[model samples]
Target chain A: MLPLCISHGDLVKLFVIALLATTALAVASLFVGVSEISFFALLSGESNEKMLLVLGESRIPRTAALILAGAGMAVAGTIMQLLSRNRFVEPSTAGTVESASLGMLAVLLLAPDLPVMMKMLVAALFALAGTALFLGILRRVPLRSPVLVPLVGLMLGGVINACTTFFAYRYDLMQAMGAWTSGDFSAVLRGRYEVLWLALALTAAAYFAADRFTVAGMGKDFSTNLGLDYRKVVALGLLIVSMVTASVVVTAGILPFIGLIVPNLVSMAMGDRLRHTLPWVALSGAVLVLLCDTIGRVINAPYEIPVGSMLGIIGSIFFLSMLLRRRSRAA
Target chain B: MIEFSGVTKVYGSTTVVDDVTAQLPKGGITSIIGPNGAGKSTLLSMIARLIPCDRGTVLVDGLDVARTSGETLARRLSILRQDNHMTARLTVHDLVAFGRYPYSRGRITADDQAHIGRALGYLGLNDLGDRFLDELSGGQRQRAFVAMVLCQDTDYMLFDEPLNNLDIRHAVGMMKLLGNAARDFGKTVVVVLHDVNFASCYSNHIIVMRDGKLFLQGSPREIIRSETLEQTYGCPFEVQELGGNRIAVYYT
Candidate 1:
C-alpha cells in the first residue's frame, strides 16, 4: 500500500542522508570550540596556532565521539523502547546509566590498572544485570496502566542512583563518578575515543535485527506465534543497549535524555520503521547533541557548560511539553 | 489438526487450564466460549505458546509447541490477542506489511507484497491503507490488526475476543470473514468469542469452559441448546431457532 519501498536501496538512501547530516555537524563542531577556529584553520592547520591544535586534535575527536555516542545511545533507546513497548525506556531511565557508573567506579577503585576494554566489559555486564533485573520486575508487576511502567522504571533508577551515590561517597570515588555522570566531551582525544566506534557496529546490528525486535514488541504470545524467539530478541536487545551505553559512558560520560528524546521525536515525525527510524534517530541525535554542545561552548564564552547538563535541562523541558500535550489531548 | 493432550496451565497456585484434552479439526471455524475467569484466553494462549503450560502439551499439526523453534512453527500458526494497544505510529499498510517479517525478515519479497495487498483488500481496508492506525476508530483498528494476522498467511489462525469494541455490523462482518477464511482459504480458525449467537452461526464447533475446566464441547448444533447456554453462562437464557441460527435471548 505504501508503494513497496522496502528494499536495500531505501536503506541506502536513508544511510546516505544520515551520513551527510552527521558529517556536516561534525565539521561544524570543529569550529565551535573556545578559540573559534575557522574552516580554513581546520583544513590547513595554519591559522591561530592555539585554534589549529584544538581543532585538529581535541575538537575533531570530541565531535566524532559525540556523534557516535549520541547516535548509538538514541538507536539503543529506540530498540529498547520498541521491545519493551514503552516510550520512556532508555539507558538513563532504565537504571543502566547509574549501574554502569557504579561499575566504572568499582573498576576505578579495585583495578585501576585494568585495561579500558576490561573496564568497559565490567560496566557492560553491570548495565546488563541492571536491565535484566528491571525487566524481571516489570514482568512480575501487574502494570494494568501503561504509564505506571515508566514511573516504576524511574523509581528503579532513583533507587539505583541512591545506591550508586552511597558507594561513590563511601569509597571517595565521588570525583570519578562526578566526572562520568554528566557528559563532557573534553577528554575525547583520538586514542581515548576509538572504543565509541563500537556503537556504530551496534547500530548496524540493530538494523539487521530490527524485524525480530518489532515482533517481540507485539507481546509474548503474538511474537511466539509468529516464530520469533522472544527471549532471545529481548536478551540481544539488552546486550546491544548495555554495550552501547557503556561505550558511550566510558567515552563521553553519561549524556542524559538524548537517547529518550531523539527516538521519541523521530518516531512521531516518521513512523517507527526500525529500518527507517534508526537512521533518522541516529542523525537527529547527532544533530541535537552537536547543536547542544555548540551552544554550551558559546553561551558562556570562555567558560563552557557541559553538553550533558545542557541536554538534561533542554531534554527535560521538551519531555515535559510532550507529556503535557498528550495529557491535554486525552482530556 | 490442533491437539491438546492434558494441557494444564497454572498461574502461581491456581490452575487456569486443568488437564484439558481436545482435538480441533483442521479447516473449520472453531469458537471457544466461556464465562469470565474461565481461562478461555489462558487456554488459547497456551496453545499459541504465548504462555508455557505448567503441565501437558499442545501439538499443532503434531509439532510440539513448547519444543518447536519459533522460526520453524511461525509459518504454520499465528495468533492475535485481545488488546492490541501500541504507541508506535504506523499506517494500516505498515502494520500489515509486518506480517511478512516471519517469511522475509523485513526484506519483503514480491510475493510478500502481494500477500499484504490481498490481505488488506480482503479486510476492505484498501481505501484506508495509508491512514495511521491511531487515526482509525476502535472497530477499524481491530480490522487492521485482523488484516495483519491474515497477512501472516498461516494455516492455523487464532484470535482472542475478535469482536471486542466492534459495532453490530462490523462484528457480523468479522464473523463472516472468519467463516469465509475457514471455508474458502482452508484455514483452521480458532476464535475466543463472548457472543454465543455469532459463534453458533459462524463456527462449526464450540468449546465451552467454566471455572478453569472444560465444561462442554461439541458441534454448534449440539452445544447451542437452551439448558447448555444457561448452565455455561450461569444465567437464565432462552434459545430460539431464528433463521436457522440459535439466537439466545437473555434480556430478562
Candidate 2:
C-alpha cells in the first residue's frame, strides 16, 4: 500500500554500501589464497613476480570470475522469473548447468584435445538445447498449480544431472572434470576464465531490454494487448538465461542460489520493474558470491573448499527461510 | 464499423463460435448477451486478435483485425478480457499509465497523463490512484483495469464481463459510464454480458447468441419480448415495460 517504504536517497546509499562490501571481499579474496599476498605487500613492491603473478593470474581472475558468474547468474534468474512468471525460478531450474556439464563430459571423452574455449562453446550450445527442452515442456502442459513449473524444471534438471554423472563416470572423468563443474574458483587463471566475460556481456544485454521482459512477464494477452512482441521478448529472455548459465558453468562451474535469492531480494525491496531492480540484483549477487567465496577460501586456511560447497550449505538455509517468508507473507 | 464474415472458432472437436456473419453498427453501446458457452467471449477475443480465428476475417473500419499490425490496430481498437490477473505490483496510476504504451511506448507525455487523469475521474478512481492494485479490493481492481482501457482512448472499445466482482452500485455506475462513452464521445462500445435486463436498459443494439450462433439481433424493444426471450434462453420469461425500458424476467 505504501509506495516505497525506502526513500530514493537511502536506496542509493544502500547500493553504495553493497559496492563497498563487494570491493572489500574481492580484495580480501586476493590475499586469502595459499600464497601470502597482501595489499601492503604489493605496496612494498614485494610481489616483484610471485605476488604479481598471484594477483594477475590467480587472485584477480578468481575475483572477477566470482563477480561475473555471480552477477550473470543472478540476472539470468531474474529474467527467468520474469519470463516464466514464476518467482521461484533459478538459472539451474531449466537444466542449463547440468546440460553444460554434460557437454563438457562429452568433450572430455570424445574430443580430449580440444581447447577450453571450444569446450565452452559446446557446453553453451548444450545448455541452450537443454533450456529449450524445459521451456518446450512448459508450453505443452498447462500448470495445475503455481508450484508445478519449478517442480518440473527441478526434476528435469535432475534427469540431466543423472545423464551428466553417467557420462562422467563412464569416461573416467569424474575427478578430473568435477572441479570445473562444481563452482571452484581454484582453476581460474587469467586466460582460462575469459568466457565469463561473455556472461557479463549477456547480462548487460538483459538490462538493455529490461522493460520488454517486464511486460512479457505480465502474460501473453497483456503483452500482445500492449503491442509488445511476446514471443520475441520471451525468446530473448531464454537466450540470455541459457548463455549466462552456460558461460558460468564452463568458466566457474555451477554456482547455486545466487540467481534465485538475489533477484527475489531485490524485487522485494524495489518492486518488479526490471530497470530498477536489476542493478541491485547484480550487486547483491556479486556481494553474496564474493562473501561466500571468501568464506570458502579462509574456512580451512591455505586449503580451499569449492564455492559450490559453500553456497550449497549457505544457500539451502537461505532458500528455506525464503520459502517460509513467502508462506508467512501469503498468510 | 466492424464486420465479421463467417467467423468461426473451434477447440478440438467442439465449436466455440459457429460460422456467422454480421456487421456491427458504429458509435453506440452494442451489448452481446448470451447463455454460457454461447461464444460471446470468443467472439470478442477474435475481434481483439487475442485469440486466432480458425476461419473468416474481422474488419474494423476497413482494416482487417487479423492482418493489421498490432500497433496500427491498437490505436484504433482495444479489448479487456475476463480473468484479469496481474503478477506485477503496480499502482492504479501506473496501471492506467500503461494505456499510453501503444502511443508513447513507455514514455509518458502530458497528453497521456491528462487522459489517465480523466479516466480515473470518470471511474471515480481519482482518490485510489496512489494505491497498489493488490491493496485494492476485487471490484476496485476491476474498475482500475477498465479505467486503463478507457484511458487508451480507442475508437472501438470492447469489454468481456466487466461487471464481475462488482457490487450493484459499481456495476450500475460502470454501465452508465460505458453507455455515456458511446453516446457523448462517439465511441463504438461492445460488451459481453449475462444480465439481459442490464443489456435491455443501456444497449442501443442487443445481440443474443445461443449454441455458438447468433440467435437474434435487434433493438431492446424487439429482442426483449416474451417469445424472443424464451426462445433465446430456452426458458419461460415475463416481459415488462419499466420507465420506457423493456425489462425481462426469466424466473421460470
Candidate 3:
C-alpha cells in the first residue's frame, strides 16, 4: 500500500497557509479603496469621520462580498462540473448566471420596489429554470467527447443572454440592467451586500453532500450502481448552483471565470475527491477574487475597473492553457 | 436467482436484445457466450438494471429490478461493466474503498475496511493497491475493477466482458477466481465471455446467445457439442474431450 503519504496534518497545514494569505489580502483590501485612510491621523484621534465611515461602510462590505462571492462561485463551479461530468463547465456555462440576471431584470421591470430578498428569490427561481433547460438540452446531445457538453452549455447560455439583452434594449432598461450584469465591488455598501451570506449557506449545503457529489461525478451507471438517486443528486446540485449564481449576480454581478479557474487549480493540486478538495477550492477562489478585486480597485485608484472584466482576462488565459495541457496530454 | 421475463431492448427500428426470458441459476458461475452483436452484454445489463428493458421485467430474489429501491437492490446484486473510464486520480485502494459506498455512504467502518482488504487480497492486488489506476497495466486495471465488484459483497454478481485485456494466464486466473468465488461463497456469478473454451472449462452452466435471442443453455458438457457450437457461431466448430474437459476448437 502507499502508506497514506499526504496525511491529514498536511492538509491542515495547507489550509492554514491559504487562510493566512486570504486574511492578509482581506486586510489589504480594507485599506486600498478610493478613500485614503491615514492610520497615523486616526490613531492620534484627529477624528476623521469620513475615513472611518468609508472604511466601515464601503471597504469592509466590499471585501466581505468579494470573499463570499468568490468562494461561493468557485464551490458552485466544482459542483456543476461534478454533476455534468465535465471539467470545462461552470455556472455561467450552464446559463444559470444569465438566467439569474434575466430574473433580476424581470423583477426590476415589474416590481421595481421589491425587497432585496425577494429579488434574490426571483432570480434564483429563474436560474433554476434556466439550468433545467440547459440540462435538458444536455441530455439530448450525445456525449461522445469531453468538449461537447461545455460547448452545448455555452451555446445555451448565449441564447439566453441574447434574449435577455434584446428585451433590455427594447424596454430602454439596458443601462440599469447592464450595471447589475457586470461584476464590480464599488457599489457594495454594508446594507447592499448582506444577501451574499445566503450564498455561503448554499456552500455549506453542498459541503454536506460533497461525497455524494463525488460519487455522482463518476457517471450515471456508477452512481446508480452505488445506490445513489442520480437524478435527485443532480437536481440538488443544480439548485445549489442556481442559488449561488443568483446570490452573486444580485450582489456583485458575474465574476466570470473564478468558478472555472478556481476548481481546476485546486484539482490540479489536491486531486478530484470533492470532500477533500472543496475547502481548497473555496480558499483559492476567495483568495483569487479578493486579490483581483483589490488590484482592480488600485489599478485606476479613484476609478475602478470591474472585477468581472479583470477575471475575464485572467480566467481565459488560464482556461486556454488548461485546454492546451489537456490536448498535449491526450496527444 | 435472477428471472428475466419477456425482456426486450429496441433502438429505433432494430432490437438489440429481443425478448429474453430465462432464469439464471443460483450459486454457480454461469457464462453467457456469443458473437459480437448477439445481445449478451445487453441482456446482462438489463438484469442488473444498468439498462432498462423495453418490454418486460427482471426479478432478483423476487424484487423487480426496475421497480425496487436501488438501495435495497444494491445490497443483493452488483455488476461490473466492461468500459471503466474515470477522470479521478484514484489509487487502487481508493477505488476499491468506494465499493463500500452502498453500505457505508463513504464512511468506511472497520468491517468495510476489512472487506476492502479481503477483496484486494482475493484478487492478489495487495501489492499494487497503492498505485494509481492510470499507473497500472491494463491487466492490473482489469483486476482492480474485478476486486471492486467482489468487495461490493453482493450475493449476486454480474460482469460484462471481464477478460477484455487480460493475458492468457490472468484470463485463466480470473475464470478460476470467479468460479471459486461462486462455489466457496454460494454466490451467483453471471459473466459474459467471448472465449467458448474458457466458458466450457469454468462455467457451471453455459448460455449461448445469437441474434438477440437465447440459442442454447445447458451444462458445459451438453452445450459444448460440435452441433450446438456450430449453430451458435454460424461456423464449423470441432468439440474434443481434452484432459476430462470439453473443449471447443473454432479457429482455422
* Among all candidates shown, the one with the greatest DockQ: 1
Worst 10 residues of 2 chain A by lDDT: A1-10
Which pairs clash (backbone N, Cα, C closer than 3 Å) in model 1? A227-B70
Per-model TM-score, in order, reads 0.94, 0.93, 0.95
Ranking by lDDT: 3, 1, 2
Runs in model 1 lying further than 4 Å from the true structure? A1-21, A41-52
Task: Write down the lDDT that model 1 would get.
Answer: 0.85
Instruction: Output the lDDT of residue A178, model 3.
Output: 80
Model 2: which residue pairs collide? none
TM-score of 1: 0.94
Off by over 4 Å in 3: A1-4, A38-47, B127-131
RMSD after CA superposition, every candidate: 2.7, 2.5, 2.3
The DockQ score of candidate 2 comes to 0.55
In candidate 2 chain B, what residue range of length 10 has the lowest lDDT sum? Answer: B85-94
Among these predictions, the greatest TM-score belongs to: 3
Chain A TM-score across all models, in listed order: 0.91, 0.93, 0.95
lDDT of 1 by residue, A199-307 (tens): 8898889988877776776667667767777889999999999999998888889998887898887777666777666767888888888888888988997888999
Please, what are the lDDT tens digits per residue for candidate 3 over residues B1-252? 888889999999989898988998899999999888999999998998988999999999999999999898878998988988876656798788888989999898999999999999988999998677777888899999899889999999999999989999999989988989898998999999988888999899999999999988999999999998888888999999999899888788
* C-alpha RMSD between model 2 and the true structure: 2.5
